[model samples]
Target: TSTGKESVNATLPVGLAMVRAIRAYFEETGYLIGFKPAGGISTAKASLDWLVLMKEELGRPWLEPELFRFGASSLLTDIERQLEHHLTGHYSANHRHAMA
Candidate 1:
């Protein structure tokens, strides 16, 4: 059992533990299993935070974006804006696409 705050803080550790346990179970039975965390990640920082968490806890990097996904719409817009600026050499003034 965990307090609300502890549950939040322990999410990554608990998730990694679950992944390892599942992997071990599959390995013992001569099967293969893959795990990926999904949802709620938005900003670049949030995405990077997941990577950091995975690396710190799992001791490996998930280099491919296909292996992990961020579900936030705002993140996609931010990425597009940044890419547009990079290609055009100017930041977009379109507030309609800006993140709230």
Candidate 2:
């Protein structure tokens, strides 16, 4: 319940609450549920923080793709750009990885 600001800070509380709920559910039932931090996750830093939070709160098992996923088109752009820079020592133009 925010003012629709698409910043990471704005999303943090929501993410935290959702993660806590999932963690509690798992602890109470022993049934792991998938979590998707969808939309508005448009930056690599945001995605990284999300992974770290998931690991910290839900443990390393949440790092698996089947357990966590980002549901944004722009996130793919950021990820591809980061991957290219990591693998090739160069960052591609943002437009090059524009979400289709």
The TM-scores, one per candidate, come to 0.45, 0.78
Misplaced by over 4 Å in model 1 are: 1-32, 82-100
Total clashing pairs for each candidate: 0, 0
Over the stretch 1-100, how does candidate 2's per-residue lDDT look in tens digits? 2333455533667788888999999999999988877667778888888888889989989889899877766778888988999999999998786572
Say which candidate scores most in TM-score: 2
Positional deviation of residue 44's Cα in model 2 after best superposition, in angstroms: 0.9
In order, what is each prediction's RMSD in angstroms? 6.0, 3.4
Model 1 pairs whose backbones collide = none
The TM-score of candidate 2 is 0.78
lDDT of 1 by residue, 6-94 (tens): 32432456656765675577568955444454444445666566667655644453334543444455566666666788899876754
The TM-score, computed over Cα atoms with residue i paired to residue i, of candidate 1 is: 0.45
- Candidate 1 — worst ten consecutive residues by lDDT sum? 1-10
